[model samples]
Target chain A: MSALIEVKNLTLKFRTDEGLVTAVDDVSFTIDKGQVMGLVGESGSGKSVTAKALMHLNAKNAVYSPESKITLHTENGPVDVLSLKTARELKVVRGGAISMIFQEPMASFAPAITIGDQMVEQLQLHGDLSKAKAKAISVEMLDRVGISDPARRFDQYAFELSGGMRQRAMIAMALSTKPKLLIADEPTTALDVTIQAQVIDLMKDLVTEFHMGIIFITHDLGVIAQTADKVAVKYLGRIVEEGPVREVIRNPKHPYTQGLLAALPKLDDLDAPLTPVAGDIPSPLERPSGCVFHTRCPKIIGDVCKSKLPHDTQVDGSHRVACHLHTEVPA
Target chain B: MSETLIKARDLSVGFKIGSGFFGKSILKAVDHVDIDIEKGSFFGLVGESGSGKTTLGRALLKAVPITGGTAHYADGEVDYDLTTLAGPELKDYRKRAQLIFQDPYAALSPRMTVRDIIAEPLEVMGLTKTREETDARVREIAAKCRLNLEHLRRFPHAFSGGQRQRISIARALVSGPKFVVADESVAALDVSIQADVLNLLKELQRDLKITFLFISHDLSVVAHTCDHLAVMYLGRLVESAPTREVFKAPRHPYTKALFSAIPSLDPDDRGSAQKLEGEIPSPTNQPPGCKFHTRCPFVVDRCKVEEPVLEHPGDGHEVACHRWRELADTLAA
Candidate 1:
């Protein structure tokens, strides 16, 4: 199947007081229909920034490179995302083909409005449906997401619902639009583990039924491994590694990826000592000269790693990593 | 076994809710909890929200008012009944037991430098005779937390989440407490940075030989760090066991469901996991009888009427369940 969304050389920067700070640097990836791509990164790693750029939802100070391009394969045709300027033009991409949910359900929802009113409004805005039909669709969507007594919950405000319920409501609202690409940014980070498992299962089921491409952004490797088909590891705005989820989890190629996996507290082994990445992630202000990870990388070679940028190396048919230790650079 | 640092029997903490028309109903956040912590061991408390894990942790440290039962704290020479500690005894206990907050961003004062923030506890508690002595203690703890001397002069906002957490740890350790309650300490951190903070905590625990009450909802984290584990459900102790035993073979249905709920790293190994349905019951309006019966997959009719007491099942493991043996046998068959 052809890819659903393709992001190529998408360089994004914010105009901070300290000058242009690159949030996403030369990142490229693709997600096909019925596929789930996991964007994994730590804070300041720019995973959220990259996701935001897809819907043109970044802050006003965000400056995109001229060469950057994002193509969305909608039912109509392939449409360019970055060039859409007007809100009328942006509507087709914002909620039509793409829908996004956040880590904090409260932040995503309007606190004063009832969940039913908001969901119906979103449906009417995105599709040509009557108010009654939209309301019926909203309740059905809520019930589909496992929210019990959907009609009763429909009239409750965001505060009236519990954390898990609010998240489910948010998912219901997002999926009610039937967007071809769903971006879930740390959707389960604020939830309890059991609730998180339910949400993950619900999302997986939705993907199978709806056949929509999903971009799951989270820092938890376990969640990514369980939900994602393809995984992309980001560090300080750069894609350090990208591969099939099984291959990436089974045998990581990048040193940073290895450190992250090693650092996780594994359920199978209680005796293993968690070794953290050698040093702290460098401040965005002090962006490294050549290799972004050289300062913290454990297997750093001689001065070449310090002075030169590492090219991407193909480890297998699909696994790719960017590090000097993984590939030789021509003199 | 090592010397017992703290011991409690039938401890309960209750808060008055809706004073007017509700007639001041007592909401029992912690109901009849019994816990024992060995000296210098990591005792973990795991539970979902409204599970009373935080309240239970605070009760042991005397941060919350204990409504009933008795608690004793003894670290070799200094010994005091925590529930009845008062005046000079309470003041002394404050120095012996301390708490580390969950959010590092809000834990530290924005105006204070890192050195002053870490040194405030020493100065307030009269642990140091002079500023020089306070600085020395702050420097020692800061070095242990892997913070450089230059980082001491910066404000709390100047540092990252992991660095700020280290500063908070240094502050908590400046008073040289014997017992520490870390409530969801690393929950706000990234996974990689979480490992860093966890390692620092383990190292500090070893070097200083301080007993820790680690309260968190993450079972994987507790399994790796804690020597013993206690599972709480709606203010009750449902299960308690050694870390290895609990992970290897959990007896409580709630505990088993909780384990199965964790998303496995293997993509294809999504076993017929016993998924717990519904949210944790609110503490104010808790379920009658067994609190977990509302969500327990293997719940029976008997569980709907009578609450189960903690029963020992050998190997230092205690499970509160009416049908663990029967359930285990059925599963085996």
Candidate 2:
């Protein structure tokens, strides 16, 4: 299986009033078919932007480097995502090949229209279907997402449904398109614990049944561990560490990853105090030279970690980390 | 030893719903509940949005009026019934009880400087006679909250969500309150910044000896911060126990589901957990018997009509369930 989506040397910047605000810097990764790769980071880490760049979803002021290339694999051939100029040309990439879900389902959905209408509209965009058939398929998709009374709910407006139901409807709409890749941006962050659990199970089951690759983005490590097959930890627009979820959580090579892991409150244990990463996360405008994480890294090496960016060191098969300690010590 | 500092017995708070100003029907925000918060304890009230835990906390703080039963607040000096709090005595109660709102962005005024926001509580309470005294107290609380004095001159907009929360904590503490209601205080913050705010709250509790009613939907954050936990479901208390005990052996079916729902921080721990089905019923049309019976997996016919009363079988644990005896046997296995 070829790489479903490959991002090589991707650097995105926005020309602001002050100066160039670099959002994603030299970020490169690949998502194979049927794989779930999580992009984990706090705000300003550019995880969402990198996910959005797959479909060239950016402002007019946004600039991508000449070397930056986002290639998508298809039955026909490979297509550069950045080179697609118009909606017709980009249709194969956006909504056709990839579908994105946002944190707030209410905001993403059309308030005036019924949920079925939105799902039908989405289906109509990607495929040709009659009105009656679209309605039947939309209702079926709603039921598939575990929405009860699906037939009756087809006519009810978005506000009539609860938060969890609305989110399920959104998922159903996104999946109705039957895209190859799903970009879920903090899908369960705004939801309750029980609702979150249900959604997580649904997503996992959908992944198994649909056999679609997913780019799951979130700040919560716990959700990533449970939902994502592999994980990439980001700090200030840079990938500090990338590995399978189990490997990264159990034995993290990067200090930033370790700190984040320690910060999470475990249900199994409660006595331990939350140990925060020392020092504040620097403003994106004042990002540190060399390693972006060196400003807050607890295990920063002498001058090497400060002045020079550490090259990627292979910690194990498929696990790589960017840290001077791992690189210099030859881990 | 009088372990309990605040106790509410058969507390019920009602709100008039729909129609005219008088309204035709009453909605019970908090209904027939009993709870005991230990002296100087960090107590967690865990539930969903319409769980009534927030209303219960507000009722305890005298922020909302109590309509039924009684709540007693005692701390060495004199005991005051929360329901009948009136006149000059109520003013005293305001000083002892303060609330830290959920959204720091909405809670603080962007127009006011940090110093002014922190000092407003002290001034309104008339705790300090002069501005100098207020400043001194404000500065001390700010430092304890890990806020710089230089930043005090800046508006709330100048600070991040974490820093604004610190300022909120400083304000809540500046009143020198005995009881603090932290209503989803850290929910607005990011995962990494949440740790900093939690640590700050813990440190303040240690130094000030203030009891906090930490209300949140996030169970993990509550488990890490609170000493004791009370799980609420649709205006009712399902279970109350020590943090370790509740997390370890939750008696209520709702509590069990709450724990199981937490997406495991450990990757290996996934797939083994159970997920809950159905949504929480609206408080206005709550199901008879057990409020959670509509969604609970362990529901029987009897659970559908008879409301279970909170029964204490010794120790610090208390559970409100008819099937707890059967559950204990299965859970212990």
Candidate 3:
């Protein structure tokens, strides 16, 4: 299998009022074709910013390092995402080759626009289709999403639909363009558990059918456990742990991963007390030195964790963690 | 077992909608509910979004009007009928029975500092005679909620989602209430943060001996936090039993489907055999017979014509379903 996308030495900083906040620092990862990769992290961890960086959709305040590279696998050849400056030049990759779903469907969609029109407009942007043909395909896409009376629902506005339906419509709009990559940023956050389960099932099926690479970004460990083929745990914009989803969830080597997993409430054992990492997740503006997690880490040892950042240590052939505890300190 | 702290008999909550020209219809948010919550019990109300779990919690707190039936609240000294509670009795009940809202971000006054946010409850209820007393009470509860005294001086925006929820907890508890209604308190938080808040609540309940009416739409969270579980659907209680018993044997088809819907921590579990179909019916136009018969898979002809009453099947378990006996037999088989 070849890499569908490759991110290398990506470092992005924002000129916030507080200071220059490092959102994503030296973050590098790859997603293979047809694989679902989940970027797990809490708020302000910069998981969403990294996904935004892929589409070059960062705000004007963003400052990216020169060494940062983002390449997309396309029919023509490998295209550098950062090099595409022209709107027309970026269009091929933005919506044609890559599509993104947001946390709130209402924000992404026009409240007055019918669900079908938005989808048709998206298709029209990339493909040369007549109004009637686009309408037909839009109805088909809505039906594909398991929406009852697809034709009727397609005509209804976003507000008219339920929370679950709005999300499904957004998914439909994103997929109707037939993009190779889907950036789902907490797509199921607003949905109910049962509806979330259904949406997860739909996304899984879409991956199989479209052969699309998905960057499923969410704070939910359980959803990742059920869906993602591979997982990367992020802390303060850094990848602390990256491996196959099963290996990462079952035997996480990073203290942060262990803490996060231990914190999740479990139905299997109700008596367990969730020992959350000793303190609050530090603010992005006041990030701790040497190790980002040292501020809240229970097992922070000596001068090594306080003065020097640790290298990525391989726990197994497939698993890797960035922590001083995992590797011996240098003299 | 401790004496019943709350006894709600045939409780119903209805909202008069429209009011004039276009239409007029009675929206029954909670209808014909009967429940007994013992002192110090972590009683859970679980259901889907439109299932009236929150409404039931609010009704118990006297936040909503009780349209029909009687709800009795008696904790040793005071016994006040909820529907008729007013004046001094109602004011007193406000101090004893409080509600913790779902969203911490919205619940806390953003402009107010954490100290004032938590102290507002004590001040409003006149639980403390002076400002200093209120401040002292707020600090104590905040500390109990795992919030530091230093953090109390800052605004809510300065804290994390977890910390803000703790502030909300501090406010709910500063009144020194004997019973609390935590209505989806952990719903807005991440899974990791959820457990932290839940643990604090459990600890508070243990030390204070406060009976909690924990209401949530998520069954998995409820399964872990609650001792007794009550499943509500379309304003009706479908099933009520001990958490262990319900987890072991969910008598109602609704409860069975709910349990199966949860994405099991086990990897191999596909949730293929068990999946609920159709959305919950709109409350305004609820199905007449068994309100749930529209989506229930095992609905016999009788299920569509007559409503099922909450009946004791055996043990302490109660289920409102015509086919629960048959469902239980199938599970046994």
Top model by DockQ, which number? 1
Tens digits of per-residue lDDT, candidate 2, B1-333, equal: 646789999999999788876657888989989989988999999998789999999999898889999999997666899999899999998898899998999999989999999999888888899989988999998899888879899998777777888889999888888889999999988877899999888888888998999999998999999999999999999899998888778899888888888888878878687668888888888889988889888889999999899999998789999899889755533
Error of 1 at B69 (Å): 1.3
Worst 10 residues of 2 chain A by lDDT: A276-285
Report the CA-based lDDT of candidate 3 relative to the real structure: 0.88
Can you tell me the CAPRI class of model 1?
medium
Candidate 3, residue B317: lDDT: 96
Best model per TM-score: 1
| Local distance difference test, each candidate | 0.91, 0.89, 0.88
List the candidates' TM-scores in order.
Answer: 0.97, 0.96, 0.96
DockQ of each: 0.76, 0.73, 0.59
Query: Residue B42 deviation, candidate 2, in Å?
Result: 0.6
Candidate 1 segments exceeding 4 Å error: A329-331, B20-22, B329-333
Which pairs of residues collide in model 3?
none
- By lDDT, the best candidate is 1
Q: What is the TM-score of chain B in candidate 3?
A: 0.96
- Give the chain B TM-score for each candidate: 0.97, 0.96, 0.96
What does DockQ come to for candidate 1? 0.76
TM-score of chain A of 3: 0.97
